[model samples]
Target chain A: MTYRDAINAALAEELERDERVFLLGEDVGLFGGAMAVTKGLYERFGERRVQDMPISESAIVGGTLGAVLTGLRPVAEIMFIDFVGVCMDQIVNQIAKVRYMLGGQVEVPLVIRTQGGGGKSYAAQHSQSLEAWFMHTPGLKVVIPSTPADAKGLLKSAIRDNNPVLFIEHKLLYNEKGEVPEGEHLVPLGQARVVREGSGLTIATYSRMVGLVQQAAEGLAAEGTEVEIVDLRTLTPLDEETMFASVRKTGRFLAVEEGHLTAGVGAELVARVTKNCFDYLDGPPERVAAQDRPIPCAPALEKATLPQVEDILTAARALVG
Target chain B: MPDMTVPPLPPETMRALLQGMMRVRAFEEAVHDLYQRKLLPGMSPHLSAGQEAVAAGVCLQLRPDDYMVTTHRGHGHSLLKGMDAQRMMAELCSKETGYCHGRGGTMHIASPEVGCLGANGIVGAGLPIAVGAGLSIQYRGTDQVCVAFFGDGASNQGTFHESVNLATARKLPVVFVCENNIYALSTNFARTGATPNVVDRARGYDIPGVTVDGMAVEGVYAATTTALERARSGQGPTLIEAKTYRYYGHGASDHRPYRTKEEEAQWRCSDAIQCYGDLLIERGVATAAERDDLSARAAAEAQAAVDFAVSSPDPDPARVGDYVFA
Candidate 1:
């Protein structure tokens, strides 16, 4: 199944399983979502459960917060992660702070699903990975699934989570096909999976970057360098144990991310590995991330702006050297 | 204007309304005293001293199952919505026994049991949430109606316009109550909007909009009753703008530097609690001694709440990291 189909299946199952679960967003109902992930949900669930919201991002988020407080579990889509800037107040201040500030008086069981990545040449506004922004927040659980199986499992987990979660899907990974488990596949949040095992180096990445890292790992393996690839399913409650174990075994670390280099998730991973496994390292940890610039509309320019497989390979070679 | 005919309410109902306003006034007075004595925390208190009628009148019309979203100046609304006075005082005092276990101070006090979603700190954030609750009610096929209580200043917020439009488009069961207190902090209502009245802007949403004298409790109550009736019958939402004023400054420390003393005195002359009490007596609904007894009882209750808050234990430091997530 495709990653998009997996997400659609998760939404469909959750909506069927729980009466309180509903989906609302721009073009999500009749338009079947801009990504077509919600193509048949409106017909299956009807207009009441699958709703088409107005263009107001603030209302979409704020309304979800309100609905969750009452009884309903609302899965709201922001269409694209870049547009989250318009509704940051509701996300950062209201939704993120409600559970903490309310002293656990209320549980905000809400899932905000959005897609982010730069490969589609969708320009500066539409294509950007902003997982680091939500990872820094205290009350939010940030999840980014790399594969079809992970996407389906993580989405179901996020839906069942009693706290507010930012379920980020990579725009480039929607069409990527992979075998997914048939039923009741639930990947717990804050757990990392070792997609490939090796002893020479640990290549830590998430979302779309995981594929690039895997391609780089395969090329490195051809040259007798076995690279361990760790796909971090969730970011906020990071799987430090899995990362530390891999870094300990490989004695080399390279964090790859699609977001910008400066103060990105890659930087955090490098800092964490360096601090925790300083004794196990052969050399300084390395990182491969998008350049600190807005993604341009041109295909070559956007490709150059983002970190590619060659960049991951070079970063990995340096880390292993 | 000629004398308006006062609606004849039962003696019990009249006393209840008067006592509700009295409780709010007394509770705010005690809170002010606590702040002055430096007994409470350093947070600024947004007192609804003069706008008690709007809170009491509108909330009285709501069923226990109905939901309400309030503003930063939400003490009166919270009190009338049946939030425990002692727990509310404890919350303001930062005691663990508070409504939110001392996490949400005054601006975010919530009691979902009484159907108050929360009191928002943002200017117009509660409007959309109220609409969402309305949507939930409609989806569940419940008879519950949600009310969003905001100020005239919040009407200028985009959330207010967006929420009203959505509520109308979906015909959500909700009521939008605008407490026009004439000022958003120091800014006058005229300086904030192109329209002279908040109710005038409701025409664009195509909902029933009415303006009532907020100082007259009966007028607010009557308008709210009609709005609730319309909402419960699935007639969609109603916008009721109550023309009210704040006797105190925006916060406890704010002095009378923004408006003229004459203007302040003019509003104080028609204070909601004072007018309602006078009307009750003039209509022979209650005697003078009975009204005075209610005032004493309310003052005693306020004092008891203060004592309870003061004596309440602080949260343990070991549990400080709790409640970040469910």
Candidate 2:
């Protein structure tokens, strides 16, 4: 199944399982989503369950929060991650702080699904990986799935989570295909998977960057340099055990991410590796990430702005050296 | 006797309305005294002293299962919705016995049992959430309605328009009540708003808009009842703007620098509680002795709540990290 198809299946199954679960977004119903990930959901679930919302981002998020408070599990889509800026108050202040502020009198069972990352040449506003913003927040759970299997499993788990979750999908990985388990395939949050194993170095990455790192690992293997790749599916409930264990075994760490280099998830990974496994490391950790600049629409400029396979190979080789 | 152009409500209903306004006045006066004495910590109390009738009128019409969301100046709304005055005072005092266990403090008290979604600190933030509550009621096919109480200031916020648009588009069962107390903090509503009245903006959405005399509890109550009936029957949302005034400054610290003493005196002459008391007596609903007795009881009730808040325990410092999730 394609990653898009896997997400679609997860939504379909969850909507069927829970009577309270509903989906609302811009163009999600009739247009089948801008990415076409929600194709045929409106017909299957009807207008009540699958609502088409106006371009009011604040109402979309705040309204979803109100629904969850009064007993309803709603999945709201922001169309693109860039559009999140329009309703940051709803997401940060209202949704994230409501439960804690209310002293746990209520649980915010909400999921905000949006597509992000650089690669589509969609320009500065449309193409950006902003997971680090949500990861910094205390109450939110951040999940980004790379594979079709992980996408399906993790999404189901996110839907059932009581706390509010920001489920980020990559524009580049929607068509990526893989084998998805048939029934009840659930990947618990805060668990990391070792996609590829090696002894010399460990590469920490997530979402679309995992593919780039894997391709880099293959190229490095031909040159007799072994690299282990850890795909961190969930960012907020970070599986430090898996990361620390891998870093301790390899004695080296390199983080590859599509977000900007400054204060990115890569920076957090490096700090954590240094703090926890300083004695186990042979040298300081390294990172390969997007350039600290607005992503231009030109294909070549966009490629140069983002972390590519070559960038990962260079960063990995230096870390392994 | 005063001119009785309209028939008076039953004596029992009239007494309830008068007492409701008196309770709000007493409770807010206690909050003011607590702040002055430095007993209440955290935020400076934004007392809804003079605007009691709006809360009493609108909230009295709501059932326990019906949802309501209010503004920063929301002690009146919380109390009218059946939240304990003692616990609310404790919350203002940041005690463990508070509604939010001292976590939410003055601006974020919420009781699910009473159907209060929350007391939002952000201006105009409650409207969209009210839209959501309406959506939940509609989605569940329940007869419940959600009322969103905001200020004339909040009507200028983008959420006000967006929320109203969505609610009307979906024909969600929500009532948008605007308490036009003429001020958004120190700035007068006229200085900030393009329109003279908040109800004028409702026409842009093509929904029914009603303006009521907020100083008169009966006016607010009648308008709210009509709105509630319209919402409960699935005719979509209605915007009710209650024209009123605030007796005190924006916050406790704010003195009367913006408005004139003449203006203050004019509003105080038409004080909601005092006027309602006279109206009750003139209409033969209650005697002067009975009205005085009600006022005294409200004062005693507010004093008892203050005592409860003062004696309540402070939250344990060790549990500060709790409630960040679940």
Candidate 3:
């Protein structure tokens, strides 16, 4: 099924399963969500739960926090994650701090579902892999799902998770088709997966970059080098066990992130692995990431600035060969 | 204004009101003392020393099920809303025994059990939060009404307008109590609002707004009871402004330049805790000795809270990720 259809199925199934789950955001109601992820929810659920809110990010995020506190799982669509900056206080200050500050008295079981990544030609304002920004915050669960199955599974898990989860989907990968389970299934947080196993080297990635890693792995395998690709599905509850396990087995590591390299998710993974599995490394942990700058508008410049499949192949080759 | 019909309250209710005001006053005084000794870390404690009556008045009238979302100057509201003094003190001291377990410090304290959503540090922030609660009530088809407590400065925030207008339009079961303490942080109400009274601005939203003598517990209780009744009946929201004051600076850091000491001393004479106790005495609801006993009891309880907080254990660091996920 198409990734968009899977997301729609997840929302529909969850809505039917739990009365506490509701949807709100800009153009979420009658407009069917900006990304068409919530296509026909309004016709079924009506306007009460599938609420259309004013373009006030503060009110939307703050209201979501309040709703969850009062016993509801609210999935708010921000249209794009880059716009989340406007509601930083609501996200980092309120949502992230609620459980900790309240001494575990309350849990904001809320999900902010937004699409992000630089390949859409949506330019600087719309395109950005700011998962690193959310990943930096300990309380928040940052999920970037690349495939149709993961998009649905991750979102379902996010809705059920008590912490405030920032569920990011790649804008360009919406139409991509992949096999997904017909019924309900959940992928647990703080876990990583070996999407493609190989002994030559390990290519660690997530979200859109997982697909690039697959392409890079396939390209390198033809060159008589085997590349293992690992997908870090959930960034915050980072599965260090699986990461270190794979790295130790392969003894070579390459972290590829679509985000800027400066203090990116790559840096976090590098730091964590260094502390946990330093002895297992064959070479210094290599990061194939976007240039440390805001994404530019031109197509060629954008391609050059982002973490491409060739970059991952080059890093993978350097480590194993 | 006397046309306001009086509902007969329980005989013990007056005593309860006096007890609540005294408790808040004693509790705030302890917080002030604790601040002076540097016992509190990362706290901007906004004492409701003189403004104790508003919280006592409105919260005493509410059932334990009714919710309250308050502002930075929220210690009085929290205590009056039934938060244990010990937990509030622990919260102020940033201990694990606190309502927020050392993480919230003061601004972000919440007790879901008592229905005290929190005492927010940001101005005008609690209105939308309360509005969201009101929406939950309506969605669940319950009669629960949420009370949003804010100061005069918060009335000018964008949230105040958006929330009030939305609450009125939807006829949500919520009460907006604007404690018009004459100042916002240190800025006077007249400096920001052009409306003769902040309550008058609510007329534009088509909800009833009333300005009351905030120092009198009975007056505020009487006014809040009517508004709350109207809310529960789905008559819509009410914005009540209690003209009150704090005897101290906005945070603990103000150097007393914004207003004259005479103004502070003037408000101190009509202290809600003292005046309410006197009212109960004159009405024969309580004896002078009983009032003194009650005040002493409150003081003792506030001190006991400090002791409890000091004795509470530090949270285990491993559980830092506990509540972060369900």
lDDT of 2 by residue, A21-101 (tens): 999999999889999999999999999999999999999999998899899999999899999998898999999999889
lDDT of 1 by residue, A1-321 (tens): 999999999999999999999999999999899999999999999999999999988889989988998899999999999999988888998999988777788999999999999888899999999999998899999999999999999999999999999999988899999999987999999999999999999989999988888888899999899999999999978999999999999999999999999999989999999999999999999988999999999999998999999998887777776
Q: Write the per-residue lDDT of candidate 3 for residues A1-321, one digit (tens) a residue.
A: 988998888998898899988888889999998988898999999888788877777777777887777888888889888999877777887788778777789878999988899886777888898998888786888888878988888889988887899989888888999999878878787778889888777777898888888998888889977877889899888878888888888787888899999998898888877777789887888898999878889999889889888888778777777
Q: Write down the lDDT of every candidate, Cα atoms only.
A: 0.91, 0.92, 0.84
Rate residue B35 of model 2 by lDDT. Answer: 97
Ordered from best to worst lDDT, the candidate numbers read 2, 1, 3
Interface RMSD of each: 0.9, 0.7, 1.7
lDDT of 1: 0.91
What DockQ class does candidate 1 belong to?
Answer: high
